[model samples]
Target: MKILITGGAGFLGLHLAKYFSEHFVGNKDFCSLLDIAEFDKKEYPKNCHFIKADIRNSTLMYQYIKSMDYVIHAAAALPLWKEKDIFDINVGGTKNILEASFKNKVKRVIYVSSTAVYGVPKKHPIYENDRRVGVGSYGQSKIEAENLCFSYIKKGLNVTIIRPKTFLGTHRLGVFEILFDWIHDGKKIPVVGSGNNRYQLLDVDDLVEAIYLFVVRSGHPQGVQRQQGHPKGDLIYNGAFNIGAEKFTTVKKDLEKVFIYASSERSESRSHNKNSSRQARTISKVFPTPAFFVKKALWLFEKLKLSPLYQWVYDTADKDSFVSVKRLTETLN
Candidate 1:
């Protein structure tokens, strides 16, 4: 099977490329990586082929996707960018990919959507059908992209949409990088408010596994098509599935673990469950930052065009942003 991954040089795209190259090793199993940015060849497996091109290029997208069995559409203009730039890549690029996939008859395309479509979620365990009131243009663009996927689906294109939460692990940067830096410098980690809000995060490994499941099980015998009386059985997963960890922990507890393990090499072993008692002790040292002041600072940062993660922290600082994965689990089974 020939698989093409858009945004292949990116964090999640690179991870998926590496996974497919290492695990899907049949001679016929070829992997193609597409991205506008150039990547270090040594970082990827020899089986993975790289193609540098913008997803907005319909001709190029069609050229590469024509012979591919599957596509993982992970390209997007992340938050905190110019509004026009966000929409162009997030929405326009998606349109190009969907159009090319449809024209080329790709078997199935996994659209890597985002949980940001929920936008400052007001409810816990946010469901797939929940209203999407995107916080910013980036989130709104994601919703637009998903709508585009549905449009293509109506034309008989097989697509599965996976809305993932803020995922971490290899190639993580931005706010997460700040956490690691603070830990290395022995600086106090900032916590907005009591840091008790429950925020869910997905590990990149888990996310890769979820996408792999869709790739391996392109057919479904368990559930009916979302569209009424549709002839195709499991060719597509209509709508979207919220992807996150099954279990959730409060922000403070998560930070405690980060601090404990990241502070020193010796403390790494203590992060395991075997040292739960010791972890409990470290939790007490968690610092607190008043949400009121943080909000004010965020406002200034926005005006000054500062880091994007600050706005993210301000929005989710005192809220529960976890999601339900019940539908995903059932689909995987």
Candidate 2:
């Protein structure tokens, strides 16, 4: 199927684009990207076209989107601590994508919404049925965008919304890096409240898989309505699932754990000089490696609470949300 992925160069978008391109490969009729930022062609599987245009430009969007079978609206400005101007970008940008999708005769739209739509929840594991009470500018704008999608859905547009939890990938700039860096530097990761605030993070890989399945199923003309697994048309389902590893570790605990885990490796050499008082030439180099050095730097930064990356952990504290998801299987892999 011909497809268009907005913000294709972004962290999540890049992964999803690669995921689809690999699965579809040469057989795809067309799978293009639309983003104002230039897409790195090297990262992509094929020489797919990327239209550098913002979603806010309706005229340009409409011109390009008039006949796409699938529209994955992955474009949006993320939530910020402060708002510069709301009209032209976040809120308006969403409207532009939805309206263009409608005009384009796009069969389905797999909207990548945020769990922020349900802000400062009164309950843990924020379900799709829960009330949406956003906290600040970011959440508020997402709610507006979600409403636009629903409004379009009311007009008979096939819309499937996926709200992602805290996401981590190879090339992201939000908050997770700070904590990881802090842990690397051998520093204490600060916990906002009690440190028991369990949260789930979507690795970019898993999120891409979820989006792929959602897109393929939502747009499949031969899609069957199986109540147990596959999502149906004109329906709303929670896309963000609890996806962090073994167990949820607090900021402080996570740092200590990571440092301990990394440093726990045993030194291989020194057996020959085990209990001797002899001059030993160095050979068993384990600690003080570049990776080790970087981790140490991160630790120092986290302790100081000076690094912007470390501050990201401080930000995650206020967000009280986690995902409880159903495992989605991929046919491609």
Give the top-scoring candidate (TM-score).
Answer: 1
Compose the digit string of candidate 1's lDDT tens values, residues 189-271: 77878889898999899999899878766743323433336565565465688899988799989878776665554356455
Which parts of model 1 are misplaced by more than 4 Å?
219-232, 267-284, 310-313
**Whole-model lDDT, model 1:** 0.80
Candidate 2 per-residue lDDT over residues 1-333, each given as its tens digit: 788889888877778777787888676547888888877778876746778897888898888788788888888775432364443566788788778888777877878877767766667765666788665666777777788878888887777777777677786656667755554444444444554556566677877777676666554654434333544432433233223232464443544455655444212223544654432232121122233344456557755755543323334453455754543232222
Regions of candidate 2 where Cα sits further than 4 Å from its true position: 81-84, 173-175, 225-257, 264-320, 326-333
TM-scores of the models, in the order given = 0.88, 0.74
Model 1: how far residue 87 lies from native, Å:
0.6
TM-score attained by model 2: 0.74
Deviation (Å) of 255 in candidate 1? 1.3
lDDT leader = 1
